[model samples]
Target chain A: MLLEMLQSLPQVLIDGLALGAVYAVVALGYTMVYGILQLINFAHGEIFMTGAFIGTTFFILLMGMGWVSSVPQIFVLILVLIVTACLTGLLGMGIERVAYRPLRNAPRLIPLITAIGISFILQDVIRFIAELSSGNYIVTGPSLFTDQMTISFSSLSSIFNDASFKTSFLIVLVTAFILMISLDYFINRTKWGTAMRAVALDRETASLMSINVNKTISITFFIGSALGGATGVLFAVQYGTIDPFIGFILGMKAFIAAVLGGIGNIRGAMLGGILLGLLEMFASANLTLLTGGIFGAEYKDVFAFSILILVLIFKPEGLLGKPTAEKV
Target chain B: MPILEVNNIETYYGGIQALKGISVYVNKGEIVTLIGSNGAGKSTTLKSISGLAKVKTGSILFKGKETMNKPVHETCLLGMAHVPEGRKIFSTLTVKENLLMGAFSVNNKQLIEERMEIVFGHFPILKKRLEQKGGTMSGGEQQMLAIGRALMMEPELLMLDEPSMGLAPIIVEQIFDIIKKLNQNGITILLVEQNAYQALNIAHRGYVIRNGEIVLSGKGSELIENIEIRDAYLA
Candidate 1:
C-alpha cells in the first residue's frame, strides 16, 4: 500500500500543477488590478465569464459558417479565443469609464457597490442571451485542442499509462509559465510598468512627478481585464466547459489565491495559487484514503479556505509580501 | 513679473475654512516663505497652489497663465512641484526608482539621466543608497531623498511644506542649507514652515499668516524683527 502511494506522486503532482496554472492565470487579473486600484474590481469575475462566452460564440459561429474544413487547421481556434478575450477586455474598460469613473473621487464603498451591480448586469446579459438562443442556461463550448503529443521514458511509460493526460497537463504548465514570466518582465523592466508601480505607491507624489495618473490607471485596468479574458479562454480549453456564471466561483477562488499569496504582491499571487491548488488536491485525495470515504472530494474548497484562514492569522502579509510601515 | 501669483485664495475643508483670501507670489528666481502657527494654513497655501486641495475663490497665475483649476499632474507638467509635509516617498521602491518616478512625464531619457546626475550631486546619500528601499532610510535621509526626487522634475517653481517638520535641529539646519543652495542655483522656492525663525533666516521674503489670512509680508529680515511675529510665531 505504501509503495503504491509513493508511485502515485508524479501523477498527483502533475494534476495539482495543471489545476494551479488555471488558478494562477485567473488570480493574476485579481492581483494586478488590485495592486493599482486598491479597489477590488468585484466585477472581474463577470469579465472572465464574458471572455469565455465570447470565445464560445466565436467558435460556434465559425463552425456554423464552415470556416475551416480540415481538422488540422485548429490554430484558427486560438485566434478566435484571443479575439474574444480582447472584446471582453474592451467591455471591462467601458464599464470602468461609464460606471466607475464618475465615482473616482468618492468613497471606496461607492465603487465597490457599483462593481457588484455591474457584475450582476453582466451575468444577466449573458444568461438572457443564452436563454434566447437555447432553452438551457449553460453555453456549449467545443473542444479545439484535440490533438495531443505525449512524452515517454520507455521504462517509466508502463507506470504512467495515461499518456494523453500527461500531454495536456504539460501544455497547460508550459503556457502558464510563459505568460507569468512575460507579465513579470512587462511590469518591472518597461517604462509604463514602473509608472504603474509608482502610482500604486503614492498617487499624489506620482502626480507631482508629472505622471498622468488617470492614464496609468486606465492602462492597468485594461491589462488586468485582458489577462482575465485570456484566463477564461484557457480555462474553457482545459476543462472542456464554459458557462455564463463560471467566473463567479473561479473569481472567488482567484481572489482567495491573491489574498493567500499577498494581496498586492504580484508574484505572490502566482505562488499562492499553485500552493493552494496542491493543498486542495492533497486534502481531497489523502482524506478520502485515510478516512475511508467519510470525507469526499467536494470538500476541497473547504480545505482551501481553511488554509487561507490559517495563513491570515499567522502571516497576513503572505509568504513573500513586504510589511508596509507608514512614514510619520 | 512673477512666475506664479496667488490672489485672495479661500479654501475650506467641509464646514471649516483653512484659508480665507490669503495671497502670495513667486518671481522668476526668488525664495519666498510662509510662516505661521500650526493651523495657520501655511501648508494649505502650498496645497492650494499644487492642486492637491482646491481653492474656492482665487486667481493663480503660473507663467502668466491661470493654473488655479488645473489638476495636480497638469500643474506638475507645467513646471511646478510640491514636496508635501510627510516626504511621501514610495517606500517599497528603491532610491533610484523613486528618482526615476520623478521624471515620469519627461520622455527625454538623456535629459532624465542629466537630471539624475544633478540630483545625485545634490544628495550624494541618495546615490549611495540607489538600490536600497526608501522606507529603511532615516527621517533626515528620507527628507533629502524627497527634495532630490522633486529636483528631478526640474520645476520652474518648487513648493515645500514643512521640510523641517519632524527633523532634529542639526538635520533641520542641513535641510535649510540645501534649500539655500537650491535657491542660489536659480530654482524659485515657496517654503512653508511652522519654524518661523529658521524659515525667515533662509528666505528672501516672508509672509506671516494667522487664522488663514496673511497679516504681514515684507523682506525676511523685516519680518524677523517684527514685534508681533517675534512674540507669536518665532517663540
Candidate 2:
C-alpha cells in the first residue's frame, strides 16, 4: 500500500494543486472581509454560489442564442467570468450597505448573526430565482470545451500517458494564481489598498486622515466578492453543474481554509486553502489503502473537518497568524 | 475674519452631554489653546469643529462659512486636519505611508512631494525612519510622525489633541517648540492639552474649560498668571 501511494504521489500532487487553487481563491473573500471588519461574512458562500449560477445562466443564455457555438470558447468563458464577478461584487456591496452598515457599532454578536442571516437570505433568493427560471433546483453549466480540448504533455508522453492531464485544470490553476498575485500587489502597492490597510488597522484614524471609511469598506467587499465570483465561475466549469445549496459545503470548507491559514491574514488564507485542498485530495485518494479498507473516499469531509477541529483546539491563531494582544 | 468660529456648540455622546454651549475662535495664524482636565470637553470642541462629533445646537464656521454639518473627510479636504488624542497612526503602515495618507485629499503629485520635504524638515527623525513601521517607534517619534502627518495636509488650521500625552518632559518641550514653529509658519493652531502651563505658554490666547463649559478666557500670559487658573489648572 505504501509503495502504491508512493507511485501515485506525482498525480496526487498535480490534482491537489489544482483543487487547492480553487479553494485559495474563494478563501480570500472570507479572509479579506474578516481582516477589515472582524466579521465572518458568512454570506460570502452565497455570493460564490450566486456567481456560479450567474455564470452558468449566462452560458446557457449564450448557447440558446447560438453565440456559444460561434464564439471562441475562451472568449465565452472570459465574458461569463467578468460579468459574474461584477454582479457578485455589486451584490456584496449591497449586502454591506443594507445589512451590516447600520449595525456597525452594535455588539459583535449582532453583526455576526446578521451575516449568517444574510447567508440564508442569499441562498433562498438564489434558490427561488433558479426554481423560477429553470423549474429545477440544479443548474447545469454549458460545456464550453469538447472532449478533445486538452493539452497533451508531448515530452512526457513516453513516461506518463498524454491523455492524463486536462488543459482546463491548468487554466484554472494559472488564472487563480494570477488573480491572487494581482490582489497581493493591489493591497500592498495602491493608494486605495493603503487606505484599506489603514481602515483595517484603525477606522477612525483612517477617516481623520481624510480616507473615506465607508468607500474603503465598500471597495473591500467588492474586490473580495469579485474574487469569489471568479472562483465560482471556475468551479462551475470544472464541475459542469451547480445548485443554490452548493455554496454551503464549499463555503464551509473555504471558511475552514481561512481559519487554517489565519483568518485575518491574506497570505495565510492562500496557504491554508491549498493545504486543506491537498489534505482532502490525498486523504480521499489513500484512505482505503492506508486504513486497510476501514475508511474510504466517503470520509473525505470528515477527515477535512477533523483537521479544523484539531487546529482550533491546539493552535487557534493558525499556522501563520501571530497572537495579537488586544489593546484595552 | 477668524479662521474658525464655534458658536454655542453643544455635543453629546449617547444621552450624556460632553460639550455644552461652548464657543471659541482662532484668528488666522494664531495659536489658540483649550486647556482642561480629563473629560472637560477640550477634545470634544476640536472634534466638533473637525466634524467628528455631532453638534446638536451650534454652528461651526470655518473661514466664515458654516461647517457644523460637514463630514470629517469633507472638513479635512477643506483644509482642517485633526491629530487625534492618541497617536492613532496606522501601526502597520510605514512612516512614509502614514505621511502620504495625510495628504490623501491633496491630488497634486508635485504638492505632495513638496509637502513631504517640508514635513521631513519639521521632523528630521522621520526622514531617517521613512520605511519603519509607525507603531514600532518610541512615543516621542510617533508624536513627531503624528504631527508630521498632520502637516502633510497643508491645512489652514491644525488641531491637535494631547500631543504630549505620553511623552517625556524633554520630548514634550520639543513638541511644543515645533507647535510654536508651526504657528510661526503661518498655520492657525487649536491645541488641547492637559499640561496647562506648557499649553498656555505657547498660546496667543487660551480658554480654561471645566466640566464641558469654559470658565475663563484671556490672553495666554494673563491666563497663565490668573490666580484661579493657576490654582485650578496650572498647579
Candidate 3:
C-alpha cells in the first residue's frame, strides 16, 4: 500500500497543481474585493460560473464559424478568454454599482446579505440563458489542447511512477502564472495600482491625494472579476465539461484558500490556494490507503475544512496575514 | 480675495449635526488656524470645506470655484489638500508610494518628481525613508510625512487637522515652523489644532469654535492675548 501511494504522488502533484492554479486565480478575486471593501463578494463564484458558460458559447460559435479548423486552437482560447474576462468584469462592476455601493455605509451585514442575493441573481440569470439556448445548463465545450504529455519520475526513484497530464494542464499553469505575475506588477509598479492600495488603506485620505474612491473600487472589481472569469475559461478547457453550478463548489474552495492564506493579503491568497489544492489532492488520492480504507477519498473536503479550523484556532492571522495590532 | 471662502457651512454625521452654520476663510499667502476644544467642530469645518463631509447648506469656494458637494478627489484636483486627523497616511504603502498618491492628480511625471523634491526639502527625513512602510514611522516622522504629502500637490490652500497632535512639544514646534515657512512660500494654510497657543502664535488669523459655532474671530496676535481664549484654552 505504501508503495502504491508513493507511485501515485507524482500524478497527484500534477493534477493538484492545475487545480491549484484555478483556485489561486479565483481566490485573488475574493482577496481583492475583501481587501478594498472589507466585504465578501458572494457573487464572485457566480461570475466564475458565468465565465464558463460564456467561454463555452464562444467556443461553440467559433467552431460553427469553422474557425476551429482554420484558427489555431490556442488563439481561439485567447479570444474566448479575453471576451469572457471583459464580460464578467463588466458584470462585476455593475453588481458593485447597483447592489453594493448604495449600502456601503449601512450595517456590515446588509452588504453581506446583498452579496448573497447578487450571487443568486447571477446564478439564475446564467441558468436561464443556458437552458433557453441549449436546453440544458450543463455545457461541454469543444476539446482543445487535448494532447497528453508524460513525465518519467520512475527513472529517478523506484518508488515513484511516471506522471502524465493533458497539454491543457501546462496551458492552465502558464496562463495562471502570467495573470498572477502581471497583477503583482500592476499593483506594485503602476500608478493606478498605487491609488488602489491607498484607497484600500484609507478612503478619505486617498481622496486627499486625488484618488477617486468610487472609481478605484470599480477598478478593483474589474480586475478581480476579470481574473476569475479568465480562470473559468481555463477550467472549461482543461476539464472539457462545465455547468452553471461548478463555480459554487470551486469558488467555496477558493474562498477557503483565501482564508487559509489571509483574506486581504494578495500573495497570501496565491500561496494558500496552491497549498490547499496540493493538500486536498493528496488527501483524496492517499486517504483510503493511509486510513486503511476506513475513510474514503470523498472525505477530502472534510479534511480541507479541518485544516481551516485548525488554522483559525492556532493562527487566525493566517500564514502571511498581519497581526492587526491595535494602536495605542 | 480669499483663496478659500467657506460661508455658513452646516454638515451632519447621519442625523446628528457636527457643524452648524460654521463659516471660515483663508486668504492667499496666509496661515489661518482654527483652535477649539475636542468635539467642537474644528475638524468638521475642515471636512466640510475639503468635501469629505457633505454640506447641507451654504457654499465652499476654493480658488474662486465652487467646490462644495463635489467629490473628494475633485476637491483635491481643485488644488485643496487636507491632512486629516491622526495623520491618515496609507500605512501599508511605502513612503514613495504614499507620496505618489499625494500627486495622483498630476499627470506629468516630471512634475511629480519636482513635487517630491519640494516635499523632500520640507521633510528631508522622508527622502531617506522612501522604501519604508508609512505605518512603521514614529509619530513625529508620520506628521512630517503627512504635511509633506499635502505639499505634493502644491495646493493653493492646505488644510491640516491637528498636525501637532500626538507629538512631543519640540516636534509640535517644528511642525508649526514648517507651517509658517510654507505660508512664506506663498501656500495658503488652514490649520486646525487643540494646542491653541502654538496655533495662534503661528497663524496670521485665527477662529475660535465652540459647540459647532464660531465664537470669535480675530487677528492671531490679539486672539492669543484675549482673556476668553486664555481662560478657556490655555492651561
Residues A39-91, model 3: lDDT tens digits: 99888988898888888888988898964688788898898999999999998
First chain TM-score in every candidate? 0.90, 0.93, 0.97
Off by over 4 Å in 2: A146-163, A326-328
Among incorrect, acceptable, medium and high, the docking class of model 1 is medium
DockQ value of candidate 2: 0.66
What is the RMSD, in Å, between candidate 1 and the native fold over all Cα? 2.3
- Local error of candidate 3 at residue A240 (angstroms): 1.5
lDDT of 3 at A82: 94
Compose the digit string of candidate 2's lDDT tens values, residues B1-235.
Answer: 8999999989999999998899998999999999988888999898888888889998889998888968788888888889998888888899999998999877898999999999988999999999998888998999999999999989999999999998899999999999999999999999999998999999999999988999899999999889898655543
List candidate 1 segments past 4 Å from native: A64-74, A148-168
The full ranking of all candidates by lDDT, starting with the best, is: 3, 2, 1
Ranked by DockQ from best down, the candidates are 3, 1, 2
Q: List the residue pairs that clash in candidate 2.
A: none
Q: lDDT, candidate 2, residue A166?
A: 62
Chain A alone, model 3, TM-score? 0.97
In terms of lDDT, the poorest run of 10 residues in model 1 chain A is A159-168
